[model samples]
Target: MFDSSKRQIGFAPPSIDNECIAAVERVLRSGWITSGPELKAFENDLETYLKSPRVLCFSSWTTACELALRWFGVGPGDDVLIPAMTYAATANIVLHCGARPVMVDIDPIERVVTLEKLQAAWTPQTKAVMPVDLGGWPVDYKAIGNWLNSAPIRERFQATSAVQETFGRPLFISDAAHSFGAHIENMPVGTQADITGFSFHAVKNLTTAEGGALSFSLPSSLDLEQTTAWFRSMSLHGQSKSALEKTQSGTWQYDVVEAGYKCNMTDIQAAIGRSQLRNYPDHLNRRKEIAAQYTKALETVPWCTLPVLKDATRESAYHLFSIRINRFQSAQRDALMARLKEDGIATNVHFIPLPLLSLHRNRGEHMRHYPESEACFNEQLSLPIHLHLDDEDVTWIVERLCYHVGELMTPHA
Candidate 1:
C-alpha cells in the first residue's frame, strides 16, 4: 500500500476548474440552452481551432461515427474496414449503419491499422476504411490515402452514398475518438481523414463531461455547406431549423428531412467543451510532461515498456499512457493492477480487443483470428494521464509501479 501521505489516483478524470464551472453555469443561467448560442459559438471556435471544412457536435462518439457513416451512405451490402483492437464503438457504429465491419488487425507496435492489413481485408464490397487513432496516436492516413487512390484499390470501389458518388472513390472515414489533439502529416486529425470523429467523454483530455465532434475535409465535389445543412437537420430529428432559430418571433414552421437521430449537443455540454478547448494546449502539455516523467523513470526498468508518443509522421495527443509489461500475461497484468490499486494508484487497460468480446464473437469475430491483436491486448496497461496528476503523483505512481512489477518478476520458492 502507498504511504498515508498519498491519495488514491484515478485512471482518467476531467480537468474541471472554476472557469469550466463558470462556463457551464453561464449556459444554465441563459434562457436559451439546448443547441443555442453556446453550441454555435463552440462550433465556430472549433472550426478555427481545427481549421476544417466543418465541425458538427454530437452527444457521443458513437452517434458522431454512426451519423458520419450514414451521411456517407454506408448501409446494407457495404463493408467498412476497422481495427480489431479499438473500442467497440468503432465497429458498433459500422453495424448501426447496416454495413458489415471487416475486422482488420493492427501493426504490432503502433497498434493501428496499416495499409498492408487494409490490402488484405479489401473486398469489392468494401465502401469505407474507418481507422481508429488508437489511444491518441494518429494513424498514417497519407499512406492509406495513396492506397485508396491507386488503380488497384480504387478500381473496385463502389459509390454507396451521394457523397461517395461525388468523391468517386471509397470513403476515408476516421474513428478518431481518442485523437482530439493529435496531428499527422503536418495536419490535424480533422484534415487527415475525409471525415474524423472525436470524443469528449469525461476520461478524455478534452472533456465536455460527455460529447463528441465530427470534423472533415471532404473532396471539392462535396459542397460543405449543403452537406452541413443535411447533417444539422439529421442530428435533430430532421428539423429544418435549429431550436434557437425557432425561438425567433413568427418562425416556428419547420420540416423533417430524414427522420434523423436526436444526437445534437446541448449548449450546456458545449459550454464545458469550449472551456476545455480553451485550455487544451496546456492540458495536452501537462499530459506530455507526465508521460515523459514516466518514460524517464521506467526506461531503465527492463520489464517496463513505454508507449510510443510519436513517429516520423504522426504525433499522439497524449491521451493515454499505456505501458506494456514485457512477457507479462493478462493474469500478471491484472495482478499488477490489483497491486497498484492497493498502493493508491489507479490504472486501466486501454481496451479489450473487439474480437474477444461477446458481440463480435457472436458475429464470428473470434480472438483466435486476430493473433497480433491478441498479443497486444494481453500485455498492455494504461496509467493515469490527465491534468490532475502533479509532479509528486507521477513520481509516486511510477515508483510504486516499478517496485510492484519487479516483485512480480522475482522467483518464488
Candidate 2:
C-alpha cells in the first residue's frame, strides 16, 4: 500500500514556465499592461489559430457567455437551451439577461448536448440553443446546422416562436470553454457554431491565468464590422473609446453608447495567452498521447468505462480523461476516491449535475429527469491529464486506481 504521507499528485495545475513569466515581465515593463497592444496581438493570433474572422477576449468565460447572449439579443422572455450536465455559467448567463434557461439532457454516450435533445426541447420561446463541448469533445455541429436549415421544420418551429420570431431565426451559441483546440471534420470548434466562446482559465489546455474569447460566423444579412463594434462597445462599459484609446495622442474623446458591463481582458493576461497560443498545437498532441496511454492502461478493467474517443470525423482536445466505475454505488465511488487520496493519487469529478445543486433545486429544477447526468455524477472520476504529468506519475495513478477497484470488487470485509 502507498503511504498517505507521500507527496500527493495534483489533479491539474497551470503549466506555466519561463515563457509565461517572461511574457508577464514584458507586459509589466511596457507601461501598457491593460487592454493594449498585447491584447490586440493575442486576439489576432487566436483568430488565425481558430480560423475565424473575429475574436474578442474577456476577463473570464462567464463574462464571455453573458456578453455573447447580450450581443446576440438573448434577453427577457427568451429561452436558451443548455445541457443539464454543464457548469452553471452556461445557464447563469441566460438568467443574467432575464431569459429562461431550458435545460436539456445530454447524449448518454458523448455526454454532450445533442441535436436530438435540442430538437425535442425546442419550444415556442426558444431563442437559442447552446451546445456545450463537454470535456473537450466537440458536438455535432453539422447535424445541428442541417436541422436548423430544414425549411419546412424551421417554418413550422420558427414561426410564432418567441425567440425565433424576435431574432428572425434560432441562434446556435456554443459554450466551448472546454474545447479550445477541438475540431470536427477538420473545422475548428470556435468557427463551428454561429457564435462560440473559448475559455483560457489557468487549468485549461491553454492558460492566460483567467480569460476567454468569442468568435462568430456572421449571417449574410448582418454586418460583421458593425456587430464586432457593437460587441466591443458592450465589453467596455458601452463606451465608444476604452482607456487605452483615450491615452493616445489627440484621442482624448469618447461617448457612452449604452449601459453595459465591464469585462475586458488586459494586456498582462494576453501576453501569456500569445505564448500559449504559439505552443497550443504541441500541447494538444501531448494531451492526446496521455489520453491514449490512459485508455490502454484502464480499458481491461471490467468495471471501467472510458471517455468517448474521436471517430471518423470528430476529434477532441482531450481536456479531461474521465472514467466511470460501472456497477459502483455512490458510496463505493466515494470510497474509491478516499482510497486514491490515501495512495497519494489525485482525482476529481467534472461536475455535479446542475439540477442537484441547491441553487437550481431551489429554483424548481428537479434531478429525477436527468438520469444520465446523475449516473455520471455518481460514478465518474477525472484522472490527472495535463502537461505536468509524466510517464511514471501516470503509471502510478493507474496502478493505484486499479488497486482500489480491485478492493471494492472483493467480498464484504
Candidate 3:
C-alpha cells in the first residue's frame, strides 16, 4: 500500500557528512582502529565539552549502565528505583546485575521521576535511584540530588549503613541516553548525576555507529582518578593495559586484575564521535530550531498534546518530538499510525511502558500499577526530529498528522 513516489520521512536516522566519512577513513588507515588514540581524543573532547570531571567510553549505554551498577556494587539483595515510562534498558541493567528494579511513575507532563515518587519507593533495600532523561529532556537533577541529601534520606542510609555500606550512599545513576548535550541549572547532564550514561547510537544526535559514555561525579572521599581507572580496567576485560596500551614498545606486558566485560569503544567508533562532537553545537541549534517550528505548527491542533519545553534552568537536546493524541483510545492511536503509514509518512512510539512488556509482565509487574505510564503509552507517538530534516520535511509531517487526526476523529471512518 506504500508508494515510493510519495516522499518517505524516516522516524530517526543518522546525519552524516563528508567530515564524518573522512574521520572514519582516517581511523581505518591508521592501523589502530580498536581502542587507540582516537578513543582517547574523543573522551578528552567529551569531558571538555560537558565540563565533566571524567568520561569513560563504552560499546553501548546498556553496558555503561551495567558497569555503573557493578561499580556501585548493586547485586543480589539491592533494589534500584527506575521510572516506569522509560525504555527497558533503564531497568534491564538492574536485572543484569541481579538486583531488583523498583518501578516508579513519572510526572505526566514532564515524563520524569519526581521527588515524591522516588521517596515513596525508597526502602532499606534501595541502593540506587536511576532517573531516565525522557526524550532528551533533563530530569530535575537538583531536586533529586537535594532529596537524596536530605536529613531523612541520610538517616535511613545511616541506619542501614552496616548492611549497605558497600553500595556507597544512595547513588544517583542517570540513564541519559538521549540527552548528550542536555543541561540543567547550568550543569550538563554528564556531571549532574553521580553517574550518567550517554548514547551515541545511529539514531542519536551524536552518531557513532554504536557507542556510549559514562561520566562521574564521585564523592569527596573517593578518589576520582582512581574510580575512573577502575572503570577503565573493568571495561577492557579487567586488564591493566588496553589493546592500545599494549601496542606501545616495552608496554606489551600487562595483568588481568579481575574478570570484566569487553565493552570498550573502538577507535573506529570514536573517530565518528570526534567529528560529531566538533560539530555538535551547530547540529544542536538546528534541532532546537526544528523543535520550535514543530511547536508553532502543531499548537492549534486540538488532538495534539505537545511536550513541555519551558524549563528556564535547563534545555533538552531535542532528541525525539513526541506528542500525544489526547482523549484517544489505544485503537485510535493504532489507527492513526496505520493511516500515517499509508501516506508514506513514517512515525513511531517512543516506548511501551516497561511493565506492559511481556518480559517484565512475566517477571510479575502488573499494568494497573503504572496507570500514568500506561495512559501515555496508549496515546504517545514520536515524530521525526533529526538534524537532516529541513523546513519542508517538518511541514510535510505536520500536515500528515493533522490530516490523520481528522480522519480518526470522524464519526464514521
Which candidate's TM-score is highest? 1
Off by over 4 Å in 3: 1-5, 158-168
Q: How big is the positional error of residue 84 in model 3, measured in Å on the Cα after superposition?
A: 0.9
Candidate 1 regions exceeding 4 Å error are 1-5
lDDT of model number 3: 0.86
Candidate 3 per-residue lDDT over residues 1-413, each given as its tens digit: 33335677777878889999999998999988899889999999999999988898999999988998887777888899999998888888999989899999888888878888998999867888998888999888888988887777777773233323643368888999999888777777788788998998899989788999998876677778877888899999999998877888998999996998999999999999999999999998898999999999988888889987658898898988899888888888888888888876778887888988898999999889888888888889988888768788888788888988887888993
- The collision pairs in model 3 are none
lDDT, each prediction = 0.86, 0.85, 0.86
Candidates ranked by TM-score, best first? Answer: 1, 3, 2
Cα lDDT of model 1 by residue, 1-413, tens digit? 53645577888877899998998998899887789889988999888888886898999988888888888888999999999999988888889878899998888788888888998999989888989888898878888888887897767677766677787778888888899889776667788778888998888878888899989788887788888888888889989998888879999899885798899999999999999899888887888888888889888888777778988787899988898888888998999999999988889997899988899899887888788788777889999988878888888888888888888889889
**Error in Å for residue 307 of model 2:** 0.6
Candidate 3 TM-score to native: 0.96
Which is superior by TM-score, 1 or 2? 1
Task: Locate the minimum summed-lDDT window of 10 residues in model 2.
Answer: 158-167
Query: What lDDT would candidate 2 get against the real structure?
Result: 0.85
lDDT of 2 by residue, 217-280 (tens): 8666677888788778888999998899899899999999699788899999999999888888
TM-score of each: 0.97, 0.95, 0.96
Clash count, one per candidate:
0, 0, 0
